[model samples]
Target chain A: MTVKSKHVRIKGIKDGLVFLLDDKCPFEDLLSELRYKLEHSHQNILTGPIVHVDIKLGSRIVTEEDKEAVLEILKSQGNLLIRSIDALEAPGSKENDEALFLMSGMLRSGQVLHHQGNLLFLGDVNPGGTITCSGDIYILGALRGMAHAGVEGNEEAIIAASLLSPTQLRIADIISRPPDEWGTRESSMEFAYLTNGAMQIDKIHNIVKLRQGLNVFKGV
Target chain B: MGEAIVVTSGKGGVGKTTTTANIGTALALQGKKVCLVDTDIGLRNLDVVMGLENRIIYDLVDVAEGRCRLNQALVKDKRFDELYMLPAAQTKDKTSVTPEQVRDIILELKKEYEYILIDCPAGIEHGFRNAISGADKAIVVTTPEHAAVRDADRIIGLLEQSHVESPKLVVNRIRPGLVKSGDMLDIEDILQVLNIDLIGIVPDDELVIKAANSGEPTVMNPDSAAAIAYRNIARRILGDAVPLMQLDRKPGAFSKLKKFFGMG
Candidate 1:
C-alpha cells in the first residue's frame, strides 16, 4: 500500500480543476491515499467557493460507488464538485496555472501595477499611472491612464474597467489611439477587447458573447 | 524644531518663488519666525521678489562651501524683523550646493525658526531634489494650464515618494473670466488631475507684477487680490481655517456688474 502526493495530482484548468489519479495502485489503497492527501490539503487550495473538478483515472477500473467515495473525500475538505471521471487527462489542462491577482487602492500619477497573470484592481489609475498584465485586466474603478494587457503577446487578453477613459491601451502587439481619440469617457462599466485584430469597446454585460469558455457557469 | 516646507513647481514661471516669498512674509506677520531659502542658485529670484537681494552678503553656496556662516548668509528682511532670506548665489549653477549640504542647513535653521520655507527651483533636477530633501512638507504651485498642471502632477508623485508628507496644491494665476468662459482650466479640473489638497488659489493679478518689479512681495499689499490669496494660504499653513478668497477680481469689468448689483 503506497500513497504519495503524485497518486492524486491536482492540475488547474482554464476555468475549472482536473484531478489525475494513479492507476497502478490498488483500489482501496488509492482511496485511502486520496482521502489522506485531501484531508490535509497538500496544495492548501480550494477553501473558497465550490470549484468544479474533473477526475482522470489512468487505466484504472472503478465502480460508481468507488467514484462516490472519492467525491466524498474531496467534499469533506472543501467546496469541490466532481464533473467527470475519465480514463485520460483532459485536453489543454497541462498549461501552468496563472493566478488572478486582486488589489485595492488607486494608482496615483507615475505609479504602476504589473502582474504576470490576470489582474483585478479595485481602484482608479490616474493620468501618468499604468497597469500591465500578461493576461486579462479587470479594473473595478476608473482607468484614466494606460493599461497594457497581454504584454507577453497573448492577443486574446481583454482590459475592462468601470470607467473606461484611458490615455492609451495596448493589447498584445496592437496599440490603440491617443488620448483624444480614446477618450470616450464611458459612464457605465465597459471592457476593451481585441476582435479581428482591432480593439473595440463595449458594455461589460456583453463579455459573455465576446470570449468563449468564459461563460463556464450558467443558470447559477 | 521648525517645520520646513518646500515650495516647488515642475514648470517654470508658475509662481514658485512668488508663493514662497509671500507665504514666508505672511507667516512672519503672524509673529512666527520664518526663514526662506532660495535654491535657484543661478537664477535667484526669491531674494529679488522679497526685496532682500541687496542685503545679501553671502548666498547659499557661500554657506555650504564654508565661506560664510548661516547667520552671515541669511539676508534679513527690511520690513519684518522675524523674517529672513537665504539668497541663492547669483553666479554658481544648481550643482554648487549638494542635497546633503541643503539638508544640513535646514537642520540648523530648524532650531531657530518656527517655519523654514524653501523656494525650490523650476524643473525636477538637482536643485529641486535638494530643496525637498530636508523639508517636512511640500507645496506644489501651478497655473491653471494643461502643461503646468501636468508638470505639477509629476512633481506631486515624486514628493509623495520622498520623506516629506503628501504635497498640497496651489493653483496660481487663475483667471475667473477665462474659466467662466471655459477657456481656462477651472480649480476642479486641476484638482481632478493633481488629486491633492489645495492650499490656495491665487488669481491672475497685475498688482503681482507691479509688486515684483519693485522687489516687494505681493502679500505686503493689503488691497491686492493676489496678496489676500497668499495671506490665506499662509494662514492655512498655520493650521488656521481660512475660506478661499473669491476669484472674481473686483476691478474687472465683469466683476463690476456683479459688485454694483451686490450679487458677487
Candidate 2:
C-alpha cells in the first residue's frame, strides 16, 4: 500500500530526485515515515543506476544530530545517493526563518536562488547571478553578482562573502551605493549590513562583534 | 565514432557562426573530415559565411524530412574537399526541425565526418535546443563584453541542465588595446564569470569582416590573426595543447629593427 502521509514525499526535478519533508511534522514521525518508505517501496523508486536525492527541510530547524539521523536513514537504503540537504521557503512565515539552507555550486548568470531562512552558498556567484535570502546570507566563495539579505524585511540580517565585489547588495529594503561607486574588485573577505537604513561594508573579522546574536545562530 | 561539437552563444553578434565556419575550415585544413550543420533554420547564414551558399542543393529540413539523402543536402566546401556544410532551411522556422531529428542527423553524420560542428542560433529557444541536442561536447563562443559573458554564463547553465558535459569557452572579438585601457572586459574577467576552460581567444580583426563579406572564412586567409586563433581552436579540439595566440597589439620596442632585419 502507498504511504498516504505527506510527511515524506519523493519528488522529481530536471536533473534527479528530491525528497521533500513536511516542516510541521515531528522529526521522529518524518524519520519513521521515511524509513518505512525506504524499507518497503524503495524498490519502485530506487531501481537501475544510483539515484541522487536532495533532501529539503522546509523552514524546519534540524540540529546536527537530526541531520545525522536523517542521513543515516537515507543511507540505509542501498540505491540512494544523498546529493544535498537544504531548506526552502516554508508555506508561510508563521514561525521565524530558523532553518539554514545550504547549497554548493556556482550561481551563473540569469540564475536567482531564493531561500526563506538563513543561507550558506559554498561557491561563486557570477555577474548577473542573484541570491535572495530572508535571513543572513554567507558565501564561502566569491560574490560578484547581486545579493539581497532579509528579503522579508529583516533589517538585522547581514550578507557576508569571502570576496565581496557584488554588482549590488541589499539588506532588508536598503540598497547599496551604485555599483560604480563601489570601485574595483577587492579579494579580501567582507560583510555588508544596514546601519540606520544605509548599507555599510565592513571587514568580515568584526561580523561577530557587530552582531552578537550571530554566535547563537551559527551553531544552527 | 566522431564527436559532435555545437558552437553556441546565447547572445547575437558574439561570433557563433563565424566561430563555426572558421573552426570547421581549420579542422579541414588539418586533413580531418569535418561537417558544419547550421541549426539557425529560418535565418540560415552559416552557408553564406562558408562561401557554399550557391552550392546548397538541399537543406537540413530536406534531409530531416526524408526528402533527400544526407549527402545530397551536404554542400562541399570549395576550399577543402574534406569539409562540408549542411545549410539550414531559410523558409522554415526552428520548429520545422525537432531535437530528435537533429540528434538523428548528427548521429548519421558522425559515421562519415571526423568532426561535426553544429552552429547554434542566438537566443535560447527551440533553435538553441535543437543545436545542442546531439552534441557530445560544446563550444560556447562569446565576446569580451559584460552582456556577452553574462549570456554565455546562462548558456553554460542551460548546457549543464541538458546533460551536455563541460562546454569549452572561446572568447571572440577581443581587443587587447581596449582591455588594457580598461574600456572593455579582459579575458580574466570573462573567464571568472564563465568558469569554463578557455579553448581560444580571437582578436577583433578587420580581416574577419572582409573574409565574411567575401563569403570566405578567416581560417582560409592564413595571414589573419583570427585565422591563427581559429586554427589553434581546431588543434585544441583535436586534443593538442596549443597556447593561446599573442593578442597584445602593443608593438614591441624591437618591432622596427625586427621588421628591418626580416625577423618574424
Candidate 3:
C-alpha cells in the first residue's frame, strides 16, 4: 500500500520556527491543520523543538480576539513560547552586524520596549514608558522616562539623549537620575556610561574620543 | 451616564474608605444620584465610615450570590436622600464575588445613578481585580511613605497593564509639618515617581476621625481643611480647574490671628 504524505514546509531559524500559512485559509482552520500535522508527524507536540512561532499574517490585521485565540491554543498545548505576528511584506532580514534600530513613535504610558540591540528614538519617552536594551540607547527628544541600557551586564553600553531629564537611568549595575541641582539644563545631548564603578553623564562633546577598552570611556 | 470610579490603594490603610465616603457625599451634595459599592468583602468598613452600618440589611456578596436583590441590599444614607451604600458582606470572602458579577452590578447601577464609587480592597489580588473590572476610571490613594509609594507604583503598573486609562492620584494623610521639614515625601516627589495627574491632597486632620465617628463625611463640614480639600477634588472631577491647596504654608501667629478674627 502506498500512502501520500501531507507536508507543511518548515524553516528553522536561530530562534524558532517560521510557519507560513496560506492567506485563503481561516486562522482557526490553520491552527487545526498545524495541530494535526504536529500530532501525526514524528515530532512530539509537547516537547517540540520549536521554541518560538512567527506567524506571517500577510496583509491582515489580526484582531484582538484572534490574538487571544492563538494565545489560548498555544497555552493549552503547553507550548507557551514567545509568539509574534509579522507582515509578510516586511523588509528582508537585516544583518546582525548592523545592530541599530531607529524607532520614531510616541511610546504611550505603560508601554515597554525591550530590544537586544542598540536603539535610537526621535521622540519623547513619556512618563511611565520604559526602554530596556542590551546595547546602547540614544534619544533625540526629552527623556522624562526610564531607560536601562546594558541590561545584560554589558558595561560598555551607553545612553545619550538630547534632554537628560530622566526619572531613572540604569546602565549595568549602576543606576542614576539627573541630580536636582542639574535642574532643567539647556537642551543638549548628554552621554551616560560607567565611570569609576558608577554611572556618570557629561556633555557629549567633552568625550572627544571613545576608547574601546574594558569599561574605559575613550575621549571622543 | 453614571461613571464607576474605583477607589484603590495597593497598600492597606491609605484611606480608600474615607475617600469613597467623602466623594460619594460630595457628589450627592451636588444633586447627583450616587451609590457607593464596598468591594472589600469579609472586611467591610465603608459602611462604618459612611455611618450606614446600621442600615445595611443585605450586603454585596448576598447580591452577587443571588441571595438578595440589588435594591434590597442598597442602604440609603440618612443625611442625603440620593446617596446610597452597598455594604460589603462581612461574613463572605473575596472569592464570593467575580469580576463578571461586579461588572453586571455596575452596569445595572449606571442606569439609576450618576456616580458609582467602588471602595476597593487593599492589595493587588482577586478582590482588587474584581473591584476594578467594572470601573470607568480609578483614583489611587497613597500616603507619603516609601512603602506606600512603592505599592502605589506597582498598582499603577498593574492598572496600566490592564489598560485602565487615566488613573488619577490622591495623596492622602499628608502631614504639612513633615513635608515642610522635608521629613515626608512632597507632592512633587510623589508626582515625579507615579507620573499620574494629581487630583487632591488631603492633609492629616483630626477632624477626619471625628467625622468618621459621627457617620458624616468631612466634605460636609465647612471648617474642616480635609473636608474642603475633598470638596475641591469633587469639583475638579466635575471638570473644574480648581487650584490645589497650599499645604506648605506655615501656620504663623499672623495666620492664627486671622483665623481668630475670621479674616484672611
Candidate 4:
C-alpha cells in the first residue's frame, strides 16, 4: 500500500534514511505515519545491513513529549536505530565543524586578525598587533600582543603559545596576566584556560598532570 | 635622473630636519648639485637651520599654488654654490600642499639637481605622506632611545608599505658615556631592534648645537665629529665604502689621565 503523506519526506544518505518532518503536521499523525513506515516500508531499507536512520525536523521545535513519541515509534522496530535527531536549524554549526583559520608572518602594530573558529598563527604577534577568535588559539611563535580567545563566550577555550609574553590576554570573560619574569624565560611554552571564572596559565606539559593529580586527590 | 631621498623620523625632535640639511650640504660639498626641500609646512624650520630663512622670498606653497615659478622658490645656500633649499611656507599648514603637488615640485627639482633631499616632518600624518610621496629612497633618522627606536621601526614598516624599500637607519644623538655604562641603547642594540642597514651613527656632539644656532649645519664644519659622520654618510649614499665610526668608545685612559694632569 502506498501511503502518501504531505508532511513526511524521506532522503537516502550514506548513513541511512533521513526523515524530514514538517512542523505543520499534527504530532500524533506524524508519529503514526512514521511507525507505519517503519513497519511496512521494506523498500526504504529499514531492515537490511543498515542499522540506523536520522530524523531532521526543519524549523520545528520538538518537545520532550514529541521526543518520547518519536522514540516510542522507533522502539517498535526490532533492528532499526535512531542515529541523530537535529531540530534546531542552526546556521554554520555543521559548516564550521572543526574549522581552522591559519595566519602566517609577522603581525605588526595596528594589525588585527579575527577568525570564527580555532586560529593557528605561525608567526609572531608583535607588540601592537591583536588577534581575536571565537575558539581556541595556537601561536607557534612569540605572542607579544593582545590575544582575545573564546570571543563568543566559550569558557572552555584555551590559548597556547610557544613564547607567551603577551601584552594582554582574555579568555571568554576572564582576563589573565603573563608572569612578571616571562621574557626572562623566553623559550617557556605556556597555555591559558578558564578556571572558576578566572583565567589560569601554566606550562603546556603540566596541564595534563595537574588535572590527573586533581582527580587523584578527589579520589583519595 | 637625480635620487629623491625622504629624511623622516616618526617621532619629533629626533633631528630629521637636521639630518636632511647636513646630508644635503655634505653631498653638495662633494660637488653634487643637491636641492633640500622642506616639507614641514607649518613648522618651517629647515630654512632657519640652513641659514636660508631670510632669503625665502617664495616658499614651496608659492610654487605649488602657482604664485611663483619653481626656480623662484629655490633658496640658494650661501656656503655652497651647488646647494639649494626650497623652504616651506610659514603661514600655511601641511594640507596646503598635496602629495601630488609635492611629487610635481620634487620632479621639477630632480631635473636640475643631482640629489633631492626631502625634509619630512615628524609624525606619520598627511605631512609625512606628502614628503615621502615623491621619494625613491628613504633615510630613517632615530635617536638611541626606546621610544625613538620604536617610532623608527613603525616608520620603516610604513616606508616598506609605501614602496620605499630598505630605508637606511641613521642613529643620532648617541652618548658614549651612557652607552658604555649600559644605561642607554647602543648602536648594536638599535640595529638588533630595527634590523635595518646602518648608514651612519652621529655621536652626541656639542658642535651640532653650535652649528644649528648659527644657522649652518654641522656637516659644513670641517673639524666637528658630527660633520665627519655626516660627510661619511653622504659618501656612503654615493656608494662609497665608509666605515661606521665607533661612537661608543671614549678616548683612551692615558689620554684622559693626560688631560686631567693638564699635559698633552
Candidate 5:
C-alpha cells in the first residue's frame, strides 16, 4: 500500500494536522492520496467530529485553481477541513535564498547575514554586524557595519542604506572605506556600488550619477 | 512579573561584579525587592563585592543541582531588609549549572523579588550564556579603552542574538581628566561605536576601590561620585528620567601655567 502511494505525508501538530506534499509528485496524485488518507484515518487522526488541517505545498507554485481543487478533494472526505494553504514562496528560483528577505532589529557586531538574492533590513547594523549578499542589499536604518554586496561577483548589485556610515563597503571584488570626515549623522539615504574597479558612494538624490558611472564603466 | 536583568561584559575586570553589587544594592535601597545572582561559578566575586561573603551556606550550584532549596542558597543583605544574593560556588566550574537550570532558578526568584540582577562572567562562554538565559534585559559594562569597547560590541551582538532586548550601556571607571586631555574615549565616542542607549557613566573614583575593599558596594557611600552614578542608574531602571551626571575635569595649575606664558 505504501509503495503504490508515495506522495503526501501527514503529521499531527498542536493546533491541527499538517499535510506535507512532495513537490515532485503530480498535483492529482497528491490530492487523491490526501483524500484516501483523510477518509481511512479520520477517526484515529481526530478525537473531535470535525478537524482542520494545513496543507504545505513546498516549492510547488499553486494557482487559485490548484488551491480550490485541493479544498474540493478534502471536502469529499467529509471529516477533514482546510485551515490554511501555503504555496510556493517566490518565483524564478528553486532555492529559497533567491527570494527577497526582510529582517528587523539591531544587527550587532560579529553577526553576519548572507543572502543569495536581494535583502532588506529595517534596523541598524551596529559596528560589527556583516551583511554579505550575492544581490542588492537595502537597509531602512543605519548601516554602520560591514556590507558586502555581490559576493558571487555580480557587479550590478548595490548596497543602499538610510545612513550609510559603514566600517567597510565591498561590491564585487572592490573594497573601500569612507573618509575619516564622513561621520556626518544626516538623515539622507546613501548608496554604494562598484565602478571601474573602484567603489563609489553617493547620496540617493544623485541616483543619475550612479547610472552615469555604470554607463561610463561600460563605455570604458 | 519581576524583571531578570543580566549585567555582562565580554572583557574581564571591566567591573561586571562591581556594577551588579552597586546597582542591586541601590535598587534595594529604593525599596525594590532585589536579588543578585552570581553566575560566574568558579571565580565568584559578587558575594565578596556585596559584602555578604561571610553568609554563604549554599551556592548557585547547590540550588541548580537540587542539593539545597532556592531559599537556602540565598544570602540576605544585612543592610537592606528586602535585598538578597545568590552566591556562586567557588569550587565548581561554569558547566556545573546549565542555562535551563539557571532559567528555572530565576523563574523561582522572580516570584519573590521585584528585580533580579545576574552578575555574568566575562567571555562568551557557558557562564555568560547561563547568566543571560533568563534575562528579560541586559546591561553591558565596559571601560573607555579600545579593547574593552570592542569586547562590549561583541557581547552586545551575542545578547541581541539571544533575544535580550535593548541592552543598556554602562561605561565604567572613566577618567574625566584623560577624556578632557584627549587621552581617553568619552561617553560620546563610546556611544558612537556601540550605538546603544547609555544608562550610566561611572567616573574613576577612589571610593569605589575603598568600598570594594570593605566588601561594601559604592552605592552605600553617599560621598562617592560612583555611588550617585549607580543610584541614578538604578532610578533609570525603575523608569525614571534621570539625567546623566556631568563628568568634566577642572584644569590643574600646570595646564593653567602652560596657557599663561609662551616661554617660561
Candidate 6:
C-alpha cells in the first residue's frame, strides 16, 4: 500500500536544505516524495548544493523504519546531514566540519546523542541516556549515565566529565565502571581512556602530561 | 481537544488493563468525555474488565475494516454517561487494524472528547505499536520486579526511538511490606533503572480483582487503595501536584490488643 500524493516542500537553508512535509502524510511517503523531488529538481543527485535535509514533521508521529529510510537517503549524499526533530524546530544549518556540538539542556533519561565529531554537554546525562561519538565526549555536568566514544573503533577517544560517575563508560573496545568504593562525591573533572589494556580515569588537567609520560614510558 | 493516552506494559499480567479501566473511570468522573479503546484484538479483556462486554456490538477490528462506523463500535459505560469503551475483536487478530487507521480514529476523536485512554496489548509487537500510534502521550505500566523493569527499559528505549517524548511511568502492584522486608524491588530501584518520571504507584490490592470482576473500576470506590492511587494519577495527568499516599499496613494483634485495652 504505497500512499503517495504527499506534498514536500524543499528549500535552501543556511546549513542545508529543509524539507517541510504535510503533517498528515506517512513518513515513508514523505521520504519517497523527497527522493522524487531531489531526482526531478536537481536532475543529478551528485551535483546538488544541498548539504543537509532538515525534516519538519510538525506534530506527526514517524515510524522507526521511516526514520531509517530518511537516514539512508541522506547517507547516500555522502556529506548530507540529518538531525533530530528537535534540531529542525529552529530551522537553520551550518557547515559540516570537525567542530564541537554543545547541548546546553538536560539530557533526560532515554535520550541519545549519536555524532561523528566531538560532543560537549553542559548538563546531566541522566541514567538510561547515552552519548555515542567518534571523537571525544566532554560533559561539563554530571555524567551519571552511559557514554561511548570511538564508536567507529578509534582507540584514541576519551570521555571526560565534571562529575565522572557513569553507569557504564566505553572507549573503543574497553568498557568499565567506577570502582565499588566510589560513591557520590564532590564534582571534579576526570578523563577516561583505555590505559594499560583497561579503562582508567585520571584528573583531566593531568591528561596531556600523562599522554606525554606514556610516550616516554614506551620509549624506555 | 482530547488527547489519546495509551497505557501499555510490554510484559503480560502487569496491570495494563487495570490501569486503563481505573484511569478511564477517574477521567470520566472528572466530567471529561473519555473513551477507553481496547486494542488487544483476539485476547480482549478490557470489555470484560470494564463490564461492557454485553454491549459491544462492533469491535475495533470491525471499525478499522469499515464494517461499522466509529460510534457503532463504542460501548457506552453503565456507570458514567461520559465514559465509553471501544472493545477489541475476539475472533480477529491484531493485524486487522493498522497504525494508520488508529491514527485516523484518534484524530477524529480529538475533536469531540476530552480524553482517549487506549488499553494496549502485551508485548512490543504490532498490537503495541498500533495502540501507541495515535496517542499524544503514553503511560508505561510496569510492576516493581526485575523482569518487568527490564521490559519497561526496553519499551522506554523503543518509545524514544519512535519519538514519543516524555512517556511517563506508572509502577503498579507494589507491595510495601515486601519492599520494607527487602524481598521485593523498591520504587527507587525501578526508577534508577528505568530513569523515567514516576507518575503513580498502585499498591497490590486484592480489591483490584474484585473490582475488575464486577466491571466497576476500583477508582469508583474511594475506600479502595488501588482506586485512590488511580484517581491521584488521573489528577496528576491534569497537572495536579498531589502528594503520594502512604500504603497502610494491616495492624498486628499487639496493636489491636493495645487499643482494646486502652493502654498507652
Candidate 6 per-residue C-alpha lDDT over A1-220 given as tens digits, one digit per residue, 9 for 90 to 100? 3334757776677767776777776655677776766556544543645466677767665555555676676576665667544212221222232467776655545678888778888877766678899888999987877999988887888899988888899998888876553444555799888767577777887787656634343443
Error of 2 at B152 (Å): 0.8
**iRMS (Å) per candidate:** 1.6, 0.8, 5.0, 2.2, 1.7, 4.2
Compared with the true structure, model 4 gives a TM-score of: 0.75
**Top DockQ hit:** 2
Which of candidates 4 and 6 reaches a greater lDDT?
4
Q: For candidate 1, what is the total of clashing residue pairs?
A: 0
User: Individual DockQ of the candidates?
Assistant: 0.34, 0.58, 0.06, 0.21, 0.38, 0.06
Interface RMSD of 3: 5.0
Candidate 5: docking tier? acceptable
User: Candidate 3 — what's its lDDT?
Assistant: 0.80
Ranking by lDDT: 2, 5, 1, 4, 3, 6
Whose lDDT is higher: candidate 1's or candidate 2's?
2
Q: lDDT tens string, model 4, A148-213?
A: 999989887888899888888998988766665233453688888877887777788776753453
Cα lDDT tens digits, model 2, A50-89, are: 8888999888977777888999998887778899999643
Please give the C-alpha DockQ score of model 4: 0.21
Model 4, B1-264: lDDT tens digits are: 898999998999999988999999999989999999999999988988998888889999999999999998888899999999999998999999899999998988888899999999999899999999899999999999988987887788788789676799999998888998999898887775566799999988888998998998999777677898999999999999988886644557557446544595
Best by TM-score: 1
Error of 5 at B141 (Å): 2.1
- Write candidate 3's Cα lDDT for A1-220 as tens digits: 2213322344567877766655665666656665565555525534755378676655654656665665565555556374786643323233341368888754544568888778988877766679889888988887767999999898878889888777799999888877662455666789888877687777887655554333555579
What is the C-alpha lDDT profile of model 3 across B1-264, one tens digit per residue? 788999998999989999999988998888889999999999999989887788889888888889989999999998889999999999888999899999899989999998999999998899999999889999999999977877787788778777466799999999988998999999988876677889999999888999999888888887778988898888888888999997865657557547734796
Q: After superposition, how far is residue B205 of candidate 2 from its true place, in Å?
A: 1.4
The 10-residue segment of model 1 chain A with minimum total lDDT is A88-97
Best by lDDT: 2
